[model samples]
Target: MPEKLLFGKYELGKLLGCGAFAKVYHAREINSGKSVAIKVINKSNICNKDGIPDKKIEREVSIMRQLQHPYIVKLHEVLATKTKIYFIMEYVKGGELFNLIANKSRFSEDLSRKCFQQLISAVNYCHLRGVYHRDLKPENILIDENGDIKVSDFGLSATTDQIQSFDGLLHTVCGTPAYVAPEILTIKGYDGAKTDIWSCGIILYIMIAGYFPFYDQNLMLMYKKIYKGEFRCPKWMSPDVKRILSRLLDVNPGTRITIDEIIRDPWFRKGLKFIKFSGEEENKDSLISNSFNAFDLISFSSGLDISGLLKSNNPMDDLERMVVEESPERLIERIEELGKKENFRLRKKKDWGIEMKVQNGKVTMRLDVYRLTEHLVIMEVQKNDGDGDLYKDVWRNKLKPIILGQQIPKIEDSDS
Candidate 1:
């Protein structure tokens, strides 16, 4: 027998996540059987004393309803009752992209390129529809089970309606300090599109450098550095990366790299996965009326163990999967090559898995390869036993680029 339904239309499952103001639960659509993540937020945080939804929440819902992109999270509908509001969104099994980066400290060039490409594609689409994501930090970005980007958190977004008629710019000063554009600090006015591009540059830098490009203990000092475009690129970054980042992080918004320029750049165009939009037209009349407002979407946070923005997967939910377009044999062969080059002993296990050992077997690693289709394979990497410099050398230097080229990241989240 099925569990009792919530709202009489959805069957709720395990608690995916929760925070001070909201809880996210896995659920199934009763009629359509579609999987979704339902975020339940307390009405107190999103409504006034009179019980009307906050204007910011309403604007977020309005903006999100208009955005339909593959790389962005899909908000199916909004529901509410006396005490709480429910947000039915696409179910994303994997948590934030911030998790893997936190574990690795940095990403290989290939992986960085893949993430940046997806971000740019989504942001470009948003700008085309006159929407701007004021906050583009790691907390607002998510990854799905398929290892694809799912941009989330539109609470700080703005549309054409918010632009000032007198100056044709946005006067609001909002967003995470580290990612906010330099011009936003002036209090004069700034182009929303340009500020969004600036945030993108900061994100790309963090992916490659494992740190913020502009940061300081003093907020004013940090703002000064950002205003002056004072940042040092890591020496190990490739020439192409450094070159593009220079243009992207330019302090002068007037000269910053535009979306078209980024699309045409050789580095961004490499192995780019061009995701198509749904049948939803860019300028189609909004299908929604004001019948539904929005819940407080900022109650959830980022990090594998993160909580805050509405409801996300549990910080403890550790299942991660990636689909690769390669034969299981080919994938195994590549991993074997990496093991051999790193002077590690490898043994076959169960005809489809490999166990690797280094430093006299003190550090061990295992990979289980499964063929999902004739041409698609999924590999799971598990760590076992101790850790040492030899382990880092094998994993970071020799194995990463070869095994995870433009693939969804493989973060070591288990205790094994």
Candidate 2:
């Protein structure tokens, strides 16, 4: 009977949408009069739902907090009461992007390319931050009142923390069937970035052609076609469109065109401005100090932010973080040097660091280098297939010292 005033701040109005575990309502912030979307997640129901991992809910909160792209639905804040968790998000006046396609059979190549540019920019931005939107479909995207694309729904997303011990592959078998990558269906470890690239390609095809490139009434048959990477672009599509589509929908993840390549494509680059958003970059100092603690931030905090309401922060569990003065290139060289001395086989990542494997060919450790500033580089080490004590001993006793410019004796199995 009464309009709900959430936390004595937001005045909740009409219901915008509903899912199995949560319902979104249109709300206005009392102070700023800003129209917002409040997603109320029923704690009791979410706890009982099957196939909905608690991890997924937690990952979405953490990932959304890190992203502030114009083309993404911004999660401004997270709050909780005893019964429900509230996600205060930017309210887009326009509805789902899917509805536009449903109404119009297809978009002109020019319009399709424009939307694809914005979409790719958002996803590419996510990839650079070690976030992979495992579930990307039209329904997950929204169009704002200004008619720009906004990527939504990071519930099934995976971050760097979700990466297996040492390998860079993600094993999660998530995503809608039609848009899912072929490698994902193989049940093998798949590169999240490549899989995302494949989804982007599919979305491009649908926008221009008005239907999925790979489609069949039988689910298994459609998947088989996807696995074989069989799809025919409409004859009306431009040659450039056909060529880029082929590359994007390529079955081999190893050969898929990267985001950078897509950005440079003759078809993709047309009229692309590389637009900057309103709040594109967060503060540099705050980013480093609270990288882990900032997720689901109470804005930005040293510890115990609201993302904690969804899940606990364990920055040291699956990952090792360190700040080094050396450049990413020099750091990789040092890692190569140590790999040689330790008799471990090292695989050089295209632009990152090395993955060190042991005698059995199992990856024991993975090191990724990030340039946070001109002089400050962040190196993250993740365990892949080693014991907890072994990982700590190797990193603390041997690797850390060597990385810090102190020469240490080669690691001995006896240390384990």
TM-scores, all candidates, are 0.64, 0.73
Distance (Å) between predicted and true CA of 245, model 1?
0.9
Give the alpha carbon lDDT tens digit for every residue of 257-319 in model 1. Answer: 998888879898888754432322222122111111122122111121111233332322322
Residue-level lDDT of model 2, residues 1-416, one tens digit each, is: 12398889999999999987788999999999999998888777665454243655776776787776668898888888766788889999888877888889888999888889889878877877788998888888899987789999898898766777667689979899999999998756899999999999999899899999999999999999999998888888999999999999999999999877886677887886555333334332121121222232232232323544644544446577777888777788887887787787887654576777754654478887766566767787877776667777778876788778787866569758
Q: After TM-score superposition, what is the CA distance of residue 79 in candidate 2 from its true location, in Å?
A: 0.5
Candidate 1 residue runs with Cα over 4 Å from true position: 1-4, 14-21, 30-34, 277-416
Ten-residue region with minimum lDDT total, candidate 1: 287-296
Write down the lDDT of every candidate, Cα atoms only. 0.74, 0.78
Q: Model 1 clash pairs?
A: 299-308, 299-309, 300-308, 300-309, 301-307, 301-308, 304-315
